[model samples]
Target: MIKYEIPETLKEHENIIKRTFRYSNEIIFKCEETKPWESKLGGCPYLKNIEEYPVDEEGEPMLFLAQINLSDLEKLDDLPQKGLLQFFVVNDDMFGLESPIVVKYIEDYEENEAQLIKENPYEDNEGYKQSLPFSNNGKMYFETREMPISSSLELFETLFKDELSEEEYEKLSRDCYSCNSRVGGYPYFVQHDCLGFDDEDFLLLQLDIDDECGIMFGDSGNCVFSIPKDALKNKDFSKVIYDWQCC
Candidate 1:
């Protein structure tokens, strides 16, 4: 969930806001110094062999963006109980949208570090190109919570007016503290560029522009992945919609 408390202006309608937006279960990845095989934001990926490393459609090796060890997170009903979910993006300006975005699931945990991909994938120490974003190789510690995520301003305003008359809702819409690296929450984007998104879709991941983590999108922006509720419950990453934007 968002770290900031609810705005004082909307405190009166707290219950109403909560009632309107369904609380989405979320896992916040705390990026910190960690080991190689642990769930991490940027680091050497977890793979059985060299062949398992991902590459884009043009045969260029993809950069490892993140690896989420599902077993490291709380046992949420929608998430896998155990395994690793890894994300790889092309080393280009297109990121994963035009190029291929590889989302892989390792069902069984490989405990031994020696058995995993020990050698760094990138030839030099450069994880990303000058175009691709950069974040430190920090370990991911999961902080799970329920969040009342709003999709768009239009939907929020409509719901707000319904709960209370326009006169009653005398204040501006409260600020949303959503631009953080998180998972399984309703996505809030700087640009409403969600092309294939609909009501059926929920946020699978939001790798936001984290200044603290040194992660940037294009120009001070973030990316989000939306997936059908059933697709997430079934642990199906094939149909994931990946979109990133900048301010």
Candidate 2:
């Protein structure tokens, strides 16, 4: 599940936009304290006893794709100007499948770069896929958390809010952090010029599982912090942008 803060600036935006997708997948978001329910449609037998499953105290229920059709973007016009939006996907069809939330910042300098190469290391690395035990065949499902017009203002606040001192910017250049586990940042251009991005990019928080690094995973969910190449000169966060997927 994803959760994030809505900055005060975004509450005043007057317009929002959306692009149609090749397919519409059903999905749902549930509170961390809620339980999963069995599908009344009678599909996916593995979830027959889903009601008896133990609750996850660490977070919330596994949000799978819902059987019921849902608008890819919901309540865009009514989001609170300043509150937490915790959203997740519930799809029983892909229940128990491998999924990882990936967060990455697109460099404006890479504007001319092929989108696929920037997003996935299809040729250079098979390491991510080596660990997977099952083949999804050729089918994949994706759901995007639609951004409202207010996002532009929120992003502006995130990128320029507090002027960073040279020393502080140096530290920020070394790593990225988010107070909310489920939120992340991305560049402003992604909202405008980047078409077909919905199928490839989504804001997600991540937890690195390796123990050697001492970094706490899931302490911050898949939320993105949008940074541009110029910000690199004065920013204190790390240069690494994560590309994550859970299927």
lDDT winner among the candidates? 1
Q: Which parts of model 1 have CA positions greater than 4 angstroms off?
A: 1-15, 20-33, 123-127, 151-154, 161-172, 193-199
lDDT of candidate 2 over 70-171, digit per residue (tens):
122333222112221121222223322233321112111122322212221121234323322222111112243323222223433354346444544334
Assess candidate 1 and give its TM-score to the true structure.
0.81
For model 1, what is the alpha-carbon lDDT of residue 11? 78
lDDT of each: 0.65, 0.25
Model 1 accuracy (lDDT, Cα): 0.65
- The Cα error of candidate 1 at residue 139, in Å, is 1.4
Error of 1 at 218 (Å): 1.0
Where does the lowest 10-residue lDDT sum fall in candidate 1? 20-29
Q: Could you estimate the TM-score for every candidate?
A: 0.81, 0.21
Name the TM-score of candidate 2. 0.21
